[model samples]
Target: MSRAKNPKYESMSLEELRANMEKSKKELEHAIHNKNILEQRKRIVERKERSHRLIVKGAEFEKAFPLSRDLEQEEVQDVMEQLQNSSYNKSIVRQVYIAALHKEQQQIAEAVERAEKGDDS
Candidate 1:
């Protein structure tokens, strides 16, 4: 991207300089538009991926508790509240939460190690 030294700028007419300024403005506008398109597409993909994940999770949940498919939302919430109120279920929930957190930490540590190795190379 290095530009070669030229004496043309010193001798160029005012009109020439104005044309170059206009060209730069157009280039800047196009660059911004291109970046905005890419960002918009990225957001669209993220939204679609999230929707797909939720659909998959819903299907799995329905498979596990077929009766839940017929139950109202309030009923489901009520059932979950009761489960949480029970000490046994509460303990189990905490254990599951801790396990998930530990798994996430391990994954992050692994990623950091991989990144460090890459940097070393």
Candidate 2:
């Protein structure tokens, strides 16, 4: 029988990563209870690797496209309420937020460029 190749954890979706973590936890527990030293060590290493992958993914996501923190509480609540009232999915909401943030940043950059070019008005 041929063995299946394991997929790389870094490329896994969040849900898949969580599932892998749960599986690794169970395997580690079983290895510990069975007193299998080799399996226990292997499971520990796998679990740590998965955890590191998750952390790196989170960091990359935050760095590449972060939500705006300048929004006031009232504005945030209003957006949340509107989103809740609509049938929009989480992905749609995320896209809207990212688009708004990108537009705002672009406007700021353009204004700065104009000011640097000696255009005070």
Candidate 3:
């Protein structure tokens, strides 16, 4: 609470203050509900984006290894493990990761430059 009170509130009748407090409480609850809905929508959009990326990766995987499409989850895990165990695959993965990192950095730099120029969306 504040040490000082507003004269407006001090002059309000007890019933009027109670009504005003209830109205404020309802507005706060409504705002909280709206915030929760927006958060939920954001989570859903994130999940959808992740799902799309996974689906695209799966499609790419199937294109690379057609026979593996029919395999079970454990088999896929085994294949991934085997790939990871291979030095050639590890090197390839590293190269791809580095390329991706560079691309991301370039994109970020471009975005920053745009922002500096006040042209960023």
- Whole-model alpha-carbon lDDT for candidate 1: 0.90
Ranking by TM-score: 3, 1, 2
Candidate 2, residues 22-114: lDDT per residue as tens digits? 999999999788788787889999999999998896566456536634667687577657757776666787899999999999999999999
Candidate 3 runs further than 4 Å off? 118-121
Candidate whose lDDT is highest: 3
Output the better candidate (1/2) by lDDT.
1
Candidate 1 TM-score versus the reference: 0.64
**RMSD in angstroms, all models?**
5.9, 20.4, 2.3
What order do you get sorting by lDDT, best first? Answer: 3, 1, 2
For candidate 1, the 10 contiguous residues with the lowest summed lDDT are 112-121
- lDDT (0-100) at residue 36 of candidate 1? 100
Backbone clash tally (model 3): 0
lDDT of 1 at 91: 93
Model 3: per-residue Cα lDDT over 21-116, one tens digit each: 999999999999999999999999999999999999999999999999899999999999998899999999899999999999999999999999
